[model samples]
Target: MRVGRALPLAAAGVVALALALTGCTGTGSHADAPSPTQTAWTEAPTDSPAPTPGATAFVSSGTAAQNQPVFDAAIRKVLAKNAEADGNAVVAALKAAGFPMNATQVSQSTTSANLKPGSIMVGVKVGDSCLVGQWGAAVDGYQSTVAPVLGSGGCLIGGIPVVG
Candidate 1:
């Protein structure tokens, strides 16, 4: 079942448990049993995976429509919230500045990233090892579109030009 459907049942189970506990007054049946205590578990140590670097292609096995909002929101929120980033916001600014992307497609890859400010990078990949330049090219294309809207000598966050 979908998570939306399962949540209600899960909530009902919690409510039922609370009602059952509220009505219970005696707890003498298990008094003779061993003291209730949990044993601490120690996991066997193993080699840890290396940390993921900047933007990398992550092929999705799911629908892009479902994942697009999350990806777009993340990019938008980051650019909007940060004073140093302006890529995605530039796209929006360009649209507001009278230049809209004619053809745009954003795909989510399985790859994850933890990029520092001013060091963000994205990659388009083919298979496990083949990296594509489409992502970079697209950024440049969008930058060109936004540049005119921003005019000359304006600072940009990502692709969005920041005026004053």
Candidate 2:
């Protein structure tokens, strides 16, 4: 049942990405947006970076597609860490950027062996979709995308989702 729902949401994401890309002319290196796998997050203005830029204020009443860019920007804010970035850091950064804690799910920063996991995932449930991100040495860096929520109506299958 959940898979059934995911297909359409995934299609919508493709459509949105297509539309977003269609308008770009790539005037130069800066004109070309970062590829999904693009790395290098840096130079935050403050300890807690600001929300999405004024031009792209979050669409509180919009679809997951509408919220994705804002969410990605927020994630980038947190990614400014020079070192020691973890799932908990992403959670706090998202929260500081105005994403509610209750709507976010995150993987444990460390494994049962008390070692950092290969990667960490953070997700914010938006409407029927999720804005998901993962980062670490294993992943070679950070990546963000829109995906459907799981059958359990959450993002990560094993993510720690705070309720209340």
Candidate 3:
């Protein structure tokens, strides 16, 4: 009789263990629901102002010579992970999107951390040739900006760090 009782208790314990392992399906650990007040844009704004056609006349805080190496290294990393042409692609995309940027003429700053470790910024000529810079945040093992260049994978155009 004791053996029979022991068998039922063991079976109950196993069932409990299985339920605990599976966890509750509702409100699961990985669930990420956006708040209701947020509105997702279905399309880009048609009335938005067009981008500028050429590079702008803006003075960065630092000089190109001082920060070239850091910029080059950042570009290399971006390209290596992004099909070895992510830098060019990013520049092309910016041009296509009305922010004409020169990827080949990479520059850096001196006397400041314009391209810093945790953040990076890529400059673009916005409307009427005004300079508009797009910044990037370090994501996982990569640096990604909000607006990617042409032929690049995503909207993150550049990862060149700001050294100031």
Error of 3 at 97 (Å): 10
Better-scoring candidate (lDDT), 2 or 3? 2
The list of candidate 3 runs beyond 4 A from truth reads 1-42, 45-78, 81-99, 102-116, 123-138, 143-164
Write model 1 residue lDDT over 24-93, tens digit each, in one string. 9666777677996755433312342211333222223322222233333344444556534534443443
Best by lDDT: 2
Say which prediction, candidate 1 or candidate 3, comes out ahead on lDDT: 3
Worst 10 residues of 1 by lDDT: 141-150
Q: Write the per-residue lDDT of candidate 2 for residues 24-85, one digit (tens) a residue.
A: 85546764676575344434224333344442454545555556667766666677753358
Candidate 3 per-residue lDDT, tens place, 1-164, comes to 89999999999999999998777555555547655674542333445532223323222332232223333344444455663233345454443433324422222321165434333335442222222232333433334222323444222244342221
Against the true structure, what is each candidate's TM-score? 0.20, 0.62, 0.22
RMSD per candidate (Å) reads 19.6, 16.6, 14.2
